[model samples]
Target chain A: MMVVISYDVSTETADGKKRLRKVAKACESHAQRVQNSVFEADLDYSSFMKLKGELLKIMNKDTDSMRFYYLGNHWQRKVEHFGIKKGYNPEGTIIV
Target chain B: MMVVISYDVSTETADGKKRLRKVAKACESHAQRVQNSVFEADLDYSSFMKLKGELLKIMNKDTDSMRFYYLGNHWQRKVEHFGIKKGYNPEGTIIV
Candidate 1:
């Protein structure tokens, strides 16, 4: 499954900024950062759940918001790119 | 077709900030703001092209970037909400 994760974390204070970094780091562990606050990853059901849990723990629910778009397995046909391309491939070999 | 438009406009300069607002305004005309820099719209091919052209004119290609995700007609099944739902429905009726 391909999951697209997008988040908005309030950065008004020092703690907020720290939370933002933590949330981004959690997402970066499993996904490719396609935009400033958006990521795309190809993951199994269990891995998706793990990532979701990790992000939930990092983000402040009171001020931060997140959305997950499940592109399923046919994401290649579903995505279109424009402007500066980063050559992001969710299915490509990840050198982790 | 449901198009998810996400953009990253350089906001360091005054002109860049203006361009960011312009780009966002163009997207708001035809879509729902699902996130700070992301929008989702259910538009026909012609309308999508018009919106794309309008955004291209507003954003600077040299420093700004954008991505469009085509979710096809069955977008409802493709999108999932987590943390702070904004009640966005690309298929819902628009007053305008």
Candidate 2:
């Protein structure tokens, strides 16, 4: 499955700032950062659950916001992108 | 259908900034701003196509990027939200 995860963490205080970094780091470990607070991850059910758990632990329930869009296997057809930001195939090769 | 629209419009130039505002305004007419550049919209197929057309007109093909996630009618079950941001029922009432 390809999961699209987007988050908004409050950065009004030092604690919030730390949490923001933690959330970003957790997502970075499992996905590609398409935007500053948005990530795209291709994972199996179990891996997705584990990633979600890690994020839940780091996010502030009262101030931060996180959303997960389960794009499933047919995400390629469901997502439409336009303009300059290059789109990547979740199942394609990366030469990095 | 409920669509999740997100965009990254370059603000490195005056024209880019103008386009940003235009894009935001167009989205604001049809959806709710969930973040700086993210919006959630509830629309039928025709409305979605119309909005997409208007947005394409305002967006820059070379430096701006727009993505649309078609969540279909069962979006509520597919979307999961956590933390402070309140989720709105697309089919619910708005008392104003």
The prediction achieving the highest DockQ against the true structure is: 2
Chain B superposition TM-score per model: 0.81, 0.78
- TM-score of model 2 relative to the true fold? 0.76
Best by lDDT: 2
Fraction of the true interface contacts (Cα pairs closer than 8 Å across chains) found in each model: 0.63, 0.83
Residue A70 shift from truth in candidate 1, angstroms = 1.2
List model 2 lDDT by residue over B1-87, tens digit each: 889887866455888778767776777668876655678889988988998999999988877778888887888878888877654
Looking at model 2, the pairs that clash are: none
Residues B1-96, candidate 1, lDDT per residue (tens digit)?
898888866455888768766766787668877766778889999999999889888877766678888878888987866666443233322222
List-wise, what DockQ does each model earn?
Answer: 0.56, 0.63
B58 in model 2: Cα distance from truth in Å?
2.2
Question: How is the predicted docking of candidate 2 categorized under the CAPRI scheme?
Answer: medium
